[model samples]
Target chain A: MRLRLLCCGAALLLLAACSSTPDESLYSDGSGQLGGPPGPISPDGTIGSADLNGGQPAPGTQEDLELTVGDRVFFDYDSTVLSPVATETLDRQGAWLKQFGSIVITVEGHTDERGTREYNLALGDRRATAVKNYLVALNIAPERILTISYGEERPADPGNDETAWSNNRRAVTVVTTVN
Target chain B: MTLPRSPRARWLPALAWLAACLVLPRAAGAVVELDITEGVVEPVPIAITEFHGQTPAEQKFGRDLADVVTADLARSGLFRPLDRRAFIQSPAELIDLPRFADWRQINAEALVTGVITGGEGGTELAVEFRLWDVFAGNQMRGQRLSGTPDQWRRIAHKIADTIYARLTGEKGYFDSRIVYVAETGPTTDRVKRLAIMDQDGANHEFLTDGGDLVLTPRFHPDGNSLGFMVFRQPVPQVYKYDLLTGREARLGDFGGMTFAPRFSPDGRWLAMSQAENGNSDVYLLDLDSGRKRRLTDHPAIDTSAAFAPDGERLVFNSDRAGSPQLYTMRPDGGDVQRISFNGGNYGSPTWSPRGDLIAFTKITGGVFHIGVMKTDGSDERLLTESQLDEAPTFAPNGRVILFTRKDYRDNHIRLYTVDIAGGQVQELPTPLDASDPDWSPLRP
Candidate 1:
């Protein structure tokens, strides 16, 4: 009865908008690309989801690397070239990865929302590569590191100003198992 | 229930979105030549009489359809739909002929009248729309668009498009769809989902959940498939999604991040950008051969590739010459000609459907502009300027460009359409922040 009235309300609307209501069949298990708004789903981030429990990490763990040595290295606007600060942070990341060799880590390159989506993605890829290469120069095994570019999509800082852009443009090392 | 749950029964119940053949009018109205790109011209005032129907329920239903047609024309910034309340007669009372003087008194130069028959069946509706020149007292445009009752909104757009094409020589962009990335949540951890809707922002539906990130959806030439980038399990990759079958096929595991997938004019190949070890280059994937061909081997960032309308050449953005600019090349990656030199960095170049121009995102003076240029990159003109305007997608008719507009004050992004000739701006209302709008070809 409620759906029928909602359908009637849709008839009164400017266009046929009853279909805008959530239809159950369009929601799927992500196996098929059924397109519909699935509400309130937890964000599937590479780093957060890989955490086995909701608890804090023990000492000297990858989470500790993020907490202590810093797992991210920032970049300039449209520049993939790492700064001295970035290399130093990456040097710490390399040491952390060397100590913890069992679990593979993914380097997520991100960017500010200043550029186009495709361009920022490539820019992020370059930033990730710089971090990987800087650590590889430290004699870190290249095979242990995988790089993914989130572009401006997964921004560390969502603000539009320079402060946010500075924080947003960085390469994050996420300890993960590729969910 | 609920119109058969689209994707399972999108547009048509069976078969593909291909082979959509338009029924040309019997007698062509002189295509009204309005050089709208130049100076301001007053909008043509038109009266949209409520579509007459048999029953009370049907009459209200018919009125709703007229409202859609009315809004579609009004949003074009070319038509001024008159107040329906001023009509001397409800359409149901005067069935055969409309009183011309009644409309003329309201200064309605054109009169639109429609009829809806057998709409309640929820299966098929017999819809007819007639566009009459109020001064000439003759029928200028008439079309019978019979569609499912569920498709009343689209049928209304079809009628509006028919009148638009008859009144102006250009093809109509109404009766079209826009696939975009819908955003919610906070600025830092925004959930971007794939959403689809009509060009008028009605009949909306989200195509994907927020579980994964989706971006930059480009429609197939047939309008049945989509090529979009998704950050799913394994890593970020591009996938070609078939709207007809709801089948998602990952383009490839190119051993790196793949972004920006655009279909060729012939729908034969998808040109995309791949980044491996920080080096980005353009690559083409053959749809049938299941093979990949390298189009650019530059050490510089070479990405965001789209095909020209003729299918003979490809236009893309590259920073090989020290700054990002637009360039065109043959499919084999030869004949590399530098095209953009208007003193701004250029990226995201999309060729117009008319094959005469290309629209791109230009960053100059700390502001981004959606600019268009000739195929050879001459007569460059900026359409809209904002804090940030990126990813300009041409309307199927090639007369308007829809793009992303990021507001500086709020940092909230929205979708807006500008005239191809830089005439007007219309902000599309979405439920949440939206960006990366790709307009689909005219629906069947």
Candidate 2:
């Protein structure tokens, strides 16, 4: 009787995996393109239920740099200096880069909508460079890292308060390619 | 030239005596000279009558043209167009001769009269306008504009520019175009496109599809091309879009990101910021030679470089002093002097066309303000205060500034215009949410 119960549980797990596989593939292929149309879910009532952690990538794939390792590092107001927390995050990212030797990454610097657009662009550039520098110091190849500054154009949070501002001032590490 | 001393020219001798007194050194107790340095700050009251037209099509064009001129003048804040209801003379009556006495009774300091006629083949338009100084009792300006019927609006703006220049003794910015970023969607995943429109927000059209992220559309001094940045995933680069041909090309072959592009005063070179290995610096790219020269090599972030009107110097924002601040330097990036000292961060410093002041965005105590100061950092005046105001672009005449203001509640960004003297803040109407507006030099 115990063996039959175990077999039943295994079948249910397989069914769940089979049902979610198509949605996972759709997101991984379609939504991975920056600024592309979002993926569509099946009408199986799994919308917003499976893998809804802020659209994080699945594990073990090259895009999973954002999921398995960390993807973002936060900065203080009008500052590009890497904090202790930011350094810790960069350390993990550097290790991930070392393990995935063929994967290339782009560090996008962003700022909260506080200062002028052009200045924030420069600030974002500084933050992104700071992240790249930290990763390089941790033995990541400089040639594998690219940096861009979006200034205050792209915000992680759409709020105006301090919490949203803190979340918006971030440097995101994106996996660009894998050979 | 000599004119007969008729009753109409009766003020000639008095004006001559006044001119003589102004040109000659003053003697003791000479003519009781009055030193008048201050003038009226109120809007100059003017009346713009509906233009008289011969044919039906001409009439429609005339009415539309006159309405556009009226709106343009009213938006300047320096001119107060009297209501049409209060007009004492009709367009037909004013075609023969303006009733200056009637206009003066309505408190109109100036009067405008025009006549429109459909040209041969009904494809061309001929517009004639006369500007009369009502109090002075003289025709200040008279001109004719002929163009295709589709260009009726341009003809109207030309007339307004004439009147504006005559009365204010300054160049007009009405006959100009504004290139800006039109935004839509939520703040998190906003779609932005390059859009161009008349200075008064007419004839709006998108120059690009919202395929990739676009920002900071700046018009070249020639007014026929635009420079902006486009983001294509991992890289963003500056691009030049030719208005006449609708052709686009990358400004440089940089390996990394290049942004915040502005043309030189002569439209011969582009000043932009380039980022590599995480450090961004200002660079000047020669359009003719395809040569790139790094302007600033600071460890801190240095970008947003704008050439002065004379092209001998540049004003840019830098964080070398720990926070973003306005700085001015020679074109080759020497003699750097910090031009902002307020207890806040200053950024996006754009030199005025008149070369008297530099407009900038300032952030202090979590509030953003649009402010102006002399090139040497004196007479700092903040013209606007809000939760987020930035990217101030000066009008061609330097009497006004257009900037972006973000509503703190909804994070919706809109374009606003404020007078340099700082009184009323006027919101520019845009079909979509707009930001990063750059006013073109007065177009011919």
Residue-level lDDT tens digits of model 2 in B44-141 = 78898888887777778778988999999888877888998999888889877677799889998888888888743646577878777776666667
TM-score of chain A taken by itself, candidate 1: 0.65
The Cα error of candidate 2 at residue B40, in Å, is 7.4
Clashing pairs in 2: none
Q: After superposition, how far is residue B247 of candidate 1 from its true place, in Å?
A: 2.9
Clashing pairs in 1: A35-B206, A35-B207, A36-B206
Question: Per-residue lDDT tens digits of candidate 2, residues A33-146?
Answer: 222222233457343424232243444354455444557878888888787767766777888888888878888899998887776777788888898889888988888888
DockQ of 1: 0.50
> Ten residues in a row with the worst lDDT in model 1 chain B?
B14-23
lDDT of 1 by residue, A1-179 (tens): 99876754533441222224543322321112222342222255222222322223354555555545666777777788877766766766777777766656788899888788898888888888888788889888787778888888887665677877777788888877422
Candidate 2 RMSD computed on C-alpha atoms after optimal superposition onto the true structure: 9.5
- The C-alpha interface RMSD of every prediction is 1.1, 1.3
DockQ comparisons of all candidates to the true complex: 0.50, 0.60
How far off is residue B278 in model 2, in Å?
2.0
Each candidate structure's TM-score, on Cα atoms with residue i matched to residue i, is 0.84, 0.85
